[model samples]
Each structure stands twice: as C-alpha cells, then as structure tokens.
Target: MDLSALKQLGMDDREINLYLALFQLGPSSIRDIASHTGINRGTTYESLKQMAARGLISYAPKGKRRVFRAEDPDKLLLLAEEKKSALEGTIDSLKTNIIPGLHHLKPDFSAGNVRFYEGDDGIETVLKDILATVGQQTDKEYCVFSTKSIRHHLYRPFPNYTLQRIRRKIKVRVIAVGDGGEDAEYSERKWLKTDGPVDASYIAIYPPKVAMISMASENYPVATVLEAPEVARSQQVVFDALWGFL
Candidate 1:
C-alpha cells in the first residue's frame, strides 16, 4: 500500500515516521521516538510538537519523563473529513465570489491554455477534468455536443465513466448530432439536425474549460482541453442559445 497517502492528511515524511515510531513503541519518549526513526533529537522534538498541535499525537506524564504517543489511527478519518469540508468551502467561494470577480479583469487573449491528449488516455483525462469541475459547481451541469466518433472511442476505455458521473451527481445536457440518447437520470439529450454525421467530433462546454474529443484519425483517439474563462463563457452562451432552439 502507498504510505504517501498520509501526506494528503497533512503529515510530512518525518512526521509520519515519528508517529509510526511512537505507535509501534507504544507511548515513547521523544528521545526513544528519535532513536527508533533515526531522526535527530531537535527535528523529532519539533515534529512531535507540531503533531500535538494538530492532535495527531498527544503526550502524558509517565514518571519524571513525558511520553508521546499516536492517537487512534482512526483519527485520520477526521483529517479526511476536515479536508472535504475545507474543499467544499473553497468550491463554494469560487462559485459565489472568486469567479464572478474574475470577469472584471481584462481578458488575456493568451490565457487560452490548450492541452492535447493522445489515445484513450487523453479522452479519459478530458472526461475526468469535466467531471471534477462540474461536480464542484452548485449548478452541477455541463453542455455537450457529442457525436459517434467520440462515443465509439471513449465507451471502450471508460465504460464506467457515466456511472461515475452519476455518482458524483454531475449532470450533462447533450445535443446528439446523430440519433438515440434516451432519457437518463441527471442527463438530458436533444437531437440536432446534421448532414453526414457532423464529422465525429464531441464538444463538452463547461465553466472555465471547453473539451473536445475526436476519433477521426486512423491511429488513435485524440482530445484537447481549452481553458479560458472568456472562451468557455462564449461557448456556453452559444450552447444555451442552441439549446433553447432545440
């Protein structure tokens, strides 16, 4: 198993090592912990102090010495919960405050950062970015102009992508250029009139990013993500206008 996940809960390498040392040794002194982990005394003492501040480790009096020990390992779950709560707050702030203020700044034409992805992995990357972004918003929906070319390539590599989207409560409004997307929960589709199948391109217009996938090439599937607030807003406006007509 990856021990690096402990870093996500805000513990550094030395801190994690110190905690493990204390846990294994069962209420060790700072000196014992330093000795066990091979970390120096000064560094170990500082780490224990920081960990105690975070409630990851605690101390008690044992005779004339102070004993330090790890809290229940399950306390890591509290870190996860705190992280989730903090992320939700940040997302809410972006949606409500930060993003709206961004419009007043002059549009940087150079801000359109285009990223290209190759093969099935590229398609997966684009889809996951869309899912993560749309999942954060209160609106929780994005607009897609999908075609057979993109669908045929993506469904194989990311068959569970749709189920994952639903689990995240991310919704999509799609304009199927061909035929046959029936009603599904958290999704709405409309068929748009097109001649000769619209050349097999898929467009997903989400806030601050617009993703396009193509399967027209013989060798591999390809995708591009364009991140520009103004560009995405323009695409969204067009999608909304067309959606109204449909």
Candidate 2:
C-alpha cells in the first residue's frame, strides 16, 4: 500500500509510522514505537496524543514514564467509519450551501474543451459515458486491448454491461494478453499469453472516438476524449489493422 494513500486517509506522517509500528509490534512503549517507526521522541509523543484523542491508544502511568499501547485493532475500522460519516456530512453541507446558488445560475451555453474528473466515482462516470456512446452507436462495433489477469478484479461490473450491450446488438471484441480472458458471452473476444509487456493500461476505440484507460498508474484514473474527426478516422484504421492481426 502507498504511504501517500494512507496519508490521504487522514494520517499524519508520524501517526502513520507509529500506527504501522504498533500494528506490526502488537503493543509497545512510545520509545519502542519510536525505535521501530524511526520517529523522534517529541513526534512520537504528539502522535500518541492525537491517537489517544482519536481513541486509538491507551497508556498507563508506570513509575517515571508512561507505557503506551495501541488499542484494539477494531479502532482503525471505527476511525474509517467516522471519517466516512464526516465526509458525508461535509458533502451534505456543501450541497446545502451551493445547490440554491446552482439553481439560480443559467447553464453554460458556450462550447467547451475536455473535462477532467477525479476519484473512483469520476472514473465510473467516464466509463458510463463511454458505454452510453456505444449504446448510441447504430452499427456498434468496438474493440479493446486489455490484460485478462486483472480486468475482472477491478471491473466486476463490466460483465453484466457487455451482456446487455450484446443483447442490444452491440458487437464487442476484446483482446486480452493472458489467460482467463474477457467475459464469456461477449462477441469476438480472444486471449493470447505472451512474455511481452502487458498490464492495466487498455485502449478502446469505437467508430466516432478512441479512449485509452490508464488504470494501474499511481495517478488518478484518466481517459482522454478526442473529438477530432481525422483522429478518430486514423484510430479506426489502426484498430482495423490490429483487429486483423489478432
């Protein structure tokens, strides 16, 4: 797991380090946590203070010093739940503040360029938009290049989608680079095991547009939407060549 991702989960550097140390070491003193986490005494004390306030740790006075120990592991789950509740509350507050202003505003009548989206829901919105595009297609024929090994792991909702598309007469062609390829019951799908580089990035080209998904990269999931007529035409050409080779 990425330390940056953990930080995004509301953990400061020293707090994350100390928490991870406690998780690994079971229960230990602040000095022991500092030794394992490589955090300074002052930082450790501050982190412990914050953790205790968050109901993450407990300590008992022992002679001249206090012996700190991590609380139940379930406290992490509780913390996560609390964070989720707080975020929902914040979103509700923002919507309450902004929705009336939004209602008073007029829609943008001017044309715009590309839009950037963030987070998992944003990614899902992009995917649903692409699927809508495919649904709009008259003689739907789409092809995608992907990794079979990991597609289902991340896209568990995909199978039912393609099945529905197939029912709608949309043709699907997926070329996976490993075993257990694209979903069954989808049309024109095939797999090939290769030593060549194959991973989470996948390219999907439809008649009117081409989309490339960067799924495994550390950055946010992104797909570029191109409207250039010539670009789409050229991509279709390249897609035809690859489709034939596959």
Candidate 3:
C-alpha cells in the first residue's frame, strides 16, 4: 500500500516500514524488526523510540529483551484528527498574527511586495493564486483586463479554470483589450477599441491584490502580483473609466 499518505501524517520512511513490520511480526524485538525490514539496528531502535513517543507503539521488558508492538491500526484516525486540529490552529495564527505583520513589511514587485514569475508555469501560478486567495463566496467577484493571447497561455495549464470559476459561482468583470473572448454567466465582458495590434497583457483586480500578466513574449510569460489597496483601487478606477467608454 502507499505509505506516503502515512508519511504526510508525520511518519518517516523507516518508521512506516518498521510500523508495518511490527504489525506483521506481532510483539517484536528490535533485532527481529531490523532483520525483517533490513534497516540498521541503531536507526530502527531510534525510530521505534520516536514512534513510541508519538504513541504509535508500545513495549515491555520480557525477561531480558524488550519487545515492541504496534498500537491499534485505528490510531491512524486519531493521528489524522490531531493533525487537522494543529493545522486549524496554524491557520488561525496566520490570519490573526502572521499576515498582518507581513502586510506591514512590504508588498508588490517594485515595492519588495511584488513576486515575479516567468515561463508558462509561473503565469499559471498567478491565475491559481486568485482562486486560492478567494474562498467560496457566492458574491465574490474579480475584475480583469483580458486579452486574446491570454487564452493561448491559460488553455494549456488551466483549461478548466473558467469552468471551475463558474462552478464556484465567482463573478468576473472583464475588459477585453480587443474584440475577443466568449460570454459566460456571472461575468461582464466589454471590448476596448484598439487601432493597432494589441500587445498581450492582462490585469486582474481582486480586492487588496492586483495581478498583472504579459504573454507578448510568447513562451516567456511573466506575471506580477501587487498587494496594495490603493494600487488596486486606482486600477479599478481606470478600468471603470475605460469600461464606461465601452
């Protein structure tokens, strides 16, 4: 079976192997488990001690040898619950303590708050960040300056992004740089008149964050996310002014 999931629950590779070996060998001594798994005796001993500390295993001195036994397999559920509780605590701390401190530090590429990503994967990260930052809220909406070439970049890594957005019931107000993009529900699409060939660029305004992306360089897709309310508001105003013209 895949023990990677168990590893995520905080067990290491040797620990997983030893745990499984203990399960098979029943009440086993360090020597028995080491021989069964081909792990070094010292490492096996240390792992067993760690497992015991985690309450995953137990041992008792029988005559001169200390034999170890795995705890009930059902303890896996307890481990998962504990991890969930710890994660929830961490999330609370992040919202209440960490993020506010980081906000004061700096935000945006030019301002030390901006993160730059290059290549198609980097651009994909920018799009995915939007979805991850916005949780499930029916009225959640975002504004975007969409372009034709954006589709060429996004369709490869995130072919289902639009569909996922629709499913999440997130609304979007888009100003297409050229006469392009299709209409979708819960979205407002307007075209900006252009006389010459438009360079591939997209600016998405989502709350205290604004993401600017350019795909004009073909495979050299780049994006920057700025987390400043004033910047976002200014961009929103510009979008609205352009929006009014369309």
Candidate 4:
C-alpha cells in the first residue's frame, strides 16, 4: 500500500506504522501495537500520542490502560487542506509585508555600484536582475546592444528569459550590432551594419542600471553590472540616437 501521502501530511515512519497497526489490531493497547509492529513500546506510545494530537488516532481509557484506534482516512485530506491554507497565508504575507520590508534594508546605490559575475550561473543572475528591476518600473521597458557573436551565449544560462519577460509584460528594444537576432514579443529590433567581425559583447541599458556580457578565453562567459543613473542615461541617449537613424 503506497502510504507516501501520509508522509506528505507530516507523518513520520513510526507514526505511520503505529497508525496502520491500530487499523489491523483494532483498538489495541500500546504494548500490543508495539509488539505487532516490531517497534519499541516507549517509541510506540510517543508516536501514538502525536498521532492522536493530529486527529489521526483516537484513544479511550480501558481500566488501567488506553486502547487506540485509527481515525477515518479522510482526516488526511483535511490535514492537507489545512497545510495548503497555511502556505497561501504565508505567501500573501511575504508579498505584502516581508518582501517590501527587506527591500528597505538594501544599501543606497546612488553613489554607483558595480558587480562582476562569471560562468553560466553569473550570467543567469544578471539576466534575472534585469527583469526584476525593469519589471517594477512604470515604463517596464529597456534597451539592448547585442552583437551577433555573443547573442547565442547570452541566453544559454536563462533559456526561458524571453518567455518570462513576455509574461511580465516587460518590453525590450534591441540594437543588433551585426546580423541575426530573433524577433520576440514586447520587443523591437534594429540592425547596425558592420564590415568585419566585432568582439563578442552584449550591453543592456535599463535606466539606472546597465549590464554587459562578454566572452572570456575559450568562450567562457562573464558579466558586469553597473548601477548608475548617469551612465545608464548616457547609453540610453546613444542607443536612442542610433535607433532613430536605423
């Protein structure tokens, strides 16, 4: 019998064993249940006590001893419902109270902040931060300068990045430095003609912040994120001018 569902409801192995033992033995004493389940008498008594507290088992005093029986199996469904309700409440609190309060504790980035990241995980972090920061803004849009050489490596760490951005209604404008860039929802693309191969680099200007991704030796990915309004505004200006011409 697959009793794994009981474990999901917070029952340990001992509690499950003792609970099942009660159904088979039918109103048995702790000693009898322990003997039948091959569990120690002390452990069996404690487990049964916990099970009874959870409303999975019921006990009745009989002379000097107590006889225990398993409660209706439907109680497991009730327990799962209770857990689901508690989890929903927690998620609500996290969104409304906990998350905003924690954001208040972050250090001010007005003086400018720069961070470096390496490898696939690092690139993913940069992409996630871009979405998070831009998604909260009223405009919900950003600009990108992407080179053909680096475009494929950019989203390797975050394959679902475009899907997530589209879902959040965040828009992006891309200035393709060379050739070859895909069209995506909530995004616009323009090409910049190049005569020769350019370095593998991609830049994102998302107001108040900029992220640059490049390939190191042997195509190893690296990223730099700068949090400075002036720098971002300057890049935005250049991108806008070029976008107008293209």
Candidate 5:
C-alpha cells in the first residue's frame, strides 16, 4: 500500500501509479488504465512496457488488444531482495577497486579543500574529526574559545580521548572565557580562563586543524575547517605563545 518504498527500487512516479492502478483495477487495456489513472494514452503505454520488462507487470493479448496486469504482489519483495543483492555485489566490487587507490591520494590544499557543516550535527562532526587527528603527544593540549557558559561541554569529550592521549602522557591545555577554567574540574586537564565576549565567533586549535564556529547569528551557525599545514602551524605557534604569556 505504501508505494513510496517502490521509489528506491527505481520505479518512477508514472510506474508506481500504473502499478497501483493495475493492482486496484485488475487486468485492463491501456486506454482503460489511462482513463482510470488520469494519465494520457502514450505515457501509460510506455510505462507499461518498462514495467513488463522489469517483471513487475505482465501483458496478455485478448484478440488484437493487450491487457496489462500487475504481477504477484509477493514479487515486490523479491524485486527488493534483488536490488539489495545487486547493491551489495556492486559495493564489494567497488571496495576491491577503490580503497587501494585511495592510498595514493594525498591531501592537496592548493587545489582547494574545505568543508562547511551546519547545525548541531555539523558542529559535532567537526569536533570528532579534530579529535581523530590528535597524535601520540607527550601532552594533548587544546586551546579553545567559546561563547558564554561552559559546563560539561568542555569536560566530557576529553576523558576517553584523554585516556588515549594520557597513555602517551599527553596533557590538555584549555583557555576559555571568564570562569571557564573551573568547568574542567572532573579531569586532570588544566584550564586557563580569560575575559571576553564568549557568545559567538570562537576559534579552536586542536593540532593540524583550526576550526572556527559561529553559532546562528545573522548567518547560520556553520563550521569551516581548513586543513593546511602552514595555517595549522601558525595557529599552533600563536596558541603556544598565548598559553605561555597568559
């Protein structure tokens, strides 16, 4: 009854309409189908031809005219299964063909590479990707700037990740706006607080990547990630200098 699912099976709107029409009307001529479904004769005939070839419908001649009927409804399940199997086989072939070639593909920033993520999911993805780039450091230091009221938002993501960094003896360096130095109390991570308008346009340096997040001002709260070594190194040097002087 839900014909929408058939869309994934590559059935177009006209095909779905015709199939549903046939299911409801039983065996019928193209003219009858066209009249019943409010489709024109030419499109109805063309759609029926493809449906017959896909084994979704059948046509039988009654004298000089042909009547079209829906195939067994159970075959819909079979068609779905066939589509799944085909996709799985294609995926396996693609994996065998593509992944090995991926090793040769290097990040080329000169060719221009950047991602824009919007909404909460986009923000979360930027955070997760930054975390993944952290290497085996003697200390995992993070310099973050956030808009007002920092709570577990700062503390929770670090423990499990910090455990990995800490196994390598990596410590964290956090510098947030006023009173944020206290929020990271749950972990061994150190914090330094400064006074600023912690509302929007906060920049973060998490090694190899610099992320800037501006949350829903006049413009949408989208994230931009730049993955160039020169940019990252400059940010790193600036952060280290700020951490030392502040």
Candidate 6:
C-alpha cells in the first residue's frame, strides 16, 4: 500500500513502520509490534506514545499491558487540515505583525542597498522587481540600456515580459548598444553606433533602483540590483542625454 501520504503528514520511517504494524497485527503489545516491525520494543513504545498524542493511534489497558491500534485512516484528513490551518495562521501573523515590525529595522537607502543574484532565476527576480516597482509608480515608465548579446538572454527567463508590461501600461525607452532590438507596445527603441562587439550587458533605470545584468564566465548570467535613488536619477539623466543624441 502506498502510504506516502502518511510521510507528508510528518511521519518518519519508524513511525510509519509502527503504524503499519499495528494495522496488520491488530491490538498488539509493544513487544509484539516491535518484533513485527523489527524495531526495538523501547523505540516502538515511544513511537506509539507520540502517534497516540497526534491522534493517529489509540491504546487501551489489556490486563497489565497496553495494546495499541491504528485509528481510522480518515483521521489523516483531520491531521492535514490542522496543519493547513496552522500554516494559514502563520501567514496572517506575518502579514499583520511580523513583516511590518521587521521592515522598521531596514537601513535607509542612503547606504545604497546592493543585492547580487546568479543564474536565470536571479535574472527573473530582477525583471519581476522592475515590473512590480514601476507598476506602483505614477509615471508607469522606465528606461533600459540593452546590448545585442545580452538582449536575447534577458527575456529567456521571462518570455512574456514585454506582453506583461504592455498589459500593465508600463512604457519603456530602450537604447540599444548593438545591432538587434524589436519594437513593442508601450516601448521605443534607438540604436547606438558600434564598430566592434560590445560586452554582454543590460542596464535598467527605474526610479530608486537600477538593475545591471551581465554575462559572467562560461556565459552564465548574473545580476546586481542597487537601490539608491541618487544613483538611479544620475543614470536616468545620462540615458536621456545619450537618448537625444542617438
């Protein structure tokens, strides 16, 4: 019988063995259950005590000995519901009390919060942050400095990024550093003249934060997010200057 569900309910191998042994042996003493499951009598008794506490098993005095039996399998559903309710309560507490209290301890942006991430998942996180942060802004727009080598890889983790941006009505202005780029709704693109291959790099200038993504050794993607309003404003100024020249 596939008792994998029991494992999901936090039953270890010994507990599972003891539970199963009870089902097979009916109301049995710890010695009988231990012998049936090949677990020592002392360990078997302890496991039964724990399972009984969890309402997974029950025991009765059978003359000088305690005889244990597995409770109805439907009891597993009740156990799962209890776990789910507890988890929901924890989530509510975090949203209502814990997270807000923790936010009070965060350092101010003058220190320039910098975070580094590696791999495609990290890049996706950076992209998601751009959308989320910009989505909340009144302007609903951002700027990008994208190069040909890095442009294709940027959206691999979020293929529908442009579509989502358009759906959210978030506009973007892109200054392409090499040959290729495509136009999309709520987006404008301009190219920079280049004589040789540019290093794979992409920069996003959203107010209060700038995300830089680059290709590292072996073409692995890495990203850095700097949360500094002053730095982002400076980059936006420079991008606007170059944008007008191109």
The residue pairs that clash in candidate 2, if any, are none
Residue-wise C-alpha lDDT for candidate 3, range 1-246, written one tens digit per residue: 887889878898889999999989999889999999999899999999999999999999999999999999889989899999999999999988998888667534455657887877887788788877654445588899978766577657777888887887788999887777988987899887778877788889986789988874766778889877789889888988888988
How would you encode candidate 1's per-residue C-alpha lDDT over 84-177 as one tens digit per residue?
A: 9999999999988898888556465553478988887777778889888898899999999987555666656778888998898888899988
Candidate 2, residues 1-246: lDDT per residue as tens digits?
555555656778778778777778876777888888788888789889988887877888877788887788687777788889999998997778776676447343313324554445555665666677788777667777777544653354343665667677777787776766545554776665698666666567764566666654554466565544466678778767766776
How good is model 2 by TM-score? 0.47
Runs with alpha carbons beyond 4 Å of true place in candidate 2? 1-113, 153-159, 216-220
* TM-scores for all predictions: 0.59, 0.47, 0.84, 0.79, 0.62, 0.75
Could you tell which candidate, 1 or 5, scores higher by lDDT? 1
Residue 122, model 6, lDDT: 93
**Please, what is the whole-model Cα lDDT of each candidate in the order they appear?**
0.84, 0.68, 0.84, 0.91, 0.70, 0.91
Give the per-residue lDDT of model 6 (tens digit) for 133-154.
9998999999999999998788
Per-residue lDDT tens digits for candidate 4, residues 126-205, read 99999999998999999999999998888898999999999999999999999999998999999999999999999999
lDDT (Cα, 0-100) at 104 in candidate 3: 64
Candidate 6 clashing pairs? Answer: none
Among the numbered candidates, top TM-score falls to: 3
Tell me the tens digit of each residue's lDDT in model 5 across 1-246: 567989998899889998999989999999899999999999899999998999999999998999999999899899899999999998987778776566347655644456777765676677666555554343455566554443334323333544554554434456554553433322332344645545545566776678887756443466788767678789878777766776
Clashing pairs in 3: 107-113, 108-113, 108-114, 109-114
Provide C-alpha RMSD values for all models, in order.
Answer: 5.7, 12.7, 2.8, 3.3, 7.1, 4.0
Q: Over all chains combined, what TM-score does candidate 6 have?
A: 0.75
